[model samples]
Target: MRIDFSNWKPLTIREVNNIFSRISIYWGVAGGCALDMHLGRKTREHSDTDIVIFREDQQMVYQLLKNEWTLYKAKDGKLSLWLEGEYLDAVSDIWISRDNQSPWAFQIMLMDCEQGNWIYRREKTIKVSKEELFSTEENNVPYLKPAIQLLYKGGSSQIREKDFSDFQSVLPSLSLKEKEWLKEALKRQFPLGHSWMKSLED
Candidate 1:
């Protein structure tokens, strides 16, 4: 089925927080919005908001939203209804809406973790303590750390112009430690090299 990309009406960070407050599992804002959260300001327009939850916590999240929300699994360029209690082992992206006809609310991104460490799904060897995986800012808004978010953007097979823009916009704000972490992660994930390493090095 063809999806109407325009139908996305992402909720604000505050809204997301309010909705997720009912659940006890770990969840945090991700993607461009996450970078903006780290910067304490919006950098550009974002078509959708993404929230990440560890893959193992899917059932709890599913149970929380199953009653009031319409969830569709997005895989191989198609969408299908996500049956109740269905474990999405290989699926990573889930689109949520109020109902079949309602504008899409937000996207859920599933991440993998083991033994209290957040494992990079694309590269199992790259890991960080779950405690360091996310940050709760002054506003109490939890979000994926900028360094980790940039790692995801940089590792994309087809990096977009916005990804570059995001990197440039957030680079100046990254701490020495954050830059070092991202640089090392890029080196491991892309042994050949990465365009962002030079900037990180300097």
Candidate 2:
């Protein structure tokens, strides 16, 4: 089957985890890439890992990873780092929970808590600890879930036709249970766009 995710597997699974393990980078594999992992899709050729990191972790991330990951600034102070062919993008808002940002226009990745914690020592896939991983409470906006990482790259800050298009593609993969929770999540996370969900669903 032809895998149609936006970002392909640019690096080996081990390599992706290794780069992120340093400085406890909080990221997730979102977009078609994440869907592929969930569906057990075969590894295909890719150039980027399609990742998201917290704004607060920037300095710590640079100090530990600059030698390997070169920083490149995108429009609006948005940044990214390239390492061994994979790219990691810095999101505007990451650490705060109540203050919701945007939904990932890409794949969603969890810290692989099932595999292992994000600790470099374990040497296994970095596990996103449950306590650390955030999830949508009852509303629909994106939040971290165990074994999954949510990237907030949405809203007026990143308002682009591409963002909605990406969300539409991933909609089918979400379950009814998720759909039910998401609406509420959206309300709680994005009060401003309480109508945004309706527009997306339409």
Candidate 3:
């Protein structure tokens, strides 16, 4: 089916928190939205919001939203209806909307994990404990740490203008430890070098 990319009306952070309140598994706001949450203000307008969950918990999330929302598996530049109990092992992006005709609401991104450590899907060697991976905002909403979110943005093949904007907006807020962790992660992920590495240095 043809999906309208421009028809995105993402949910607010508080709305997402209420929707996922019943979920007992590991999940948190991710992507640019998470970075904004860490900054305690909306740095810029976002086209969509992202919620992240471990791959292992995909089914649980699927079951939760399946009845009330339309779920589509987005892979290989295609969108298809996500069937019940369908294991999207190779897929990481899932687009959700209130209904087929409604504007897209938010995206659910699946992350790889082992034991209790979060693993970077692009690079297995990069992992961090759950505590280090997420931080709860004063509003009681959980979000991916700014440094980790920046790392994800840096991994994009073509860094967009917004990605750099997010990096710059959150840089001053990051602790020394966070900067060091992100720098080391970028080093391992891009052994040759990354433009952001120099900015992350102490």
Each candidate's lDDT (Cα)?
0.91, 0.40, 0.90
Per-candidate TM vs. native? Answer: 0.97, 0.44, 0.97
- Residue 36, model 2: Cα distance from true site in angstroms: 2.2
Between prediction 2 and prediction 3, the one with superior TM-score is 3
For model 1, residues 86-172, the per-residue Cα lDDT tens digits are 999999999999988889899999999899999998888999998888898787989999999999999999899999999999999
After superposition, the stretches of candidate 1 with alpha carbons farther than 4 Å from their true spots are none
RMSD of 3: 1.0
Candidate 2 C-alpha lDDT tens digits along 24-78 = 5455444334544544443343444455445444556556654633343343434
**Residue 37's C-alpha lDDT in candidate 2?**
57
| Candidate 3, residue 194: lDDT | 95
Among all windows of 10 consecutive residues in model 3, the one with the lowest summed lDDT is 1-10
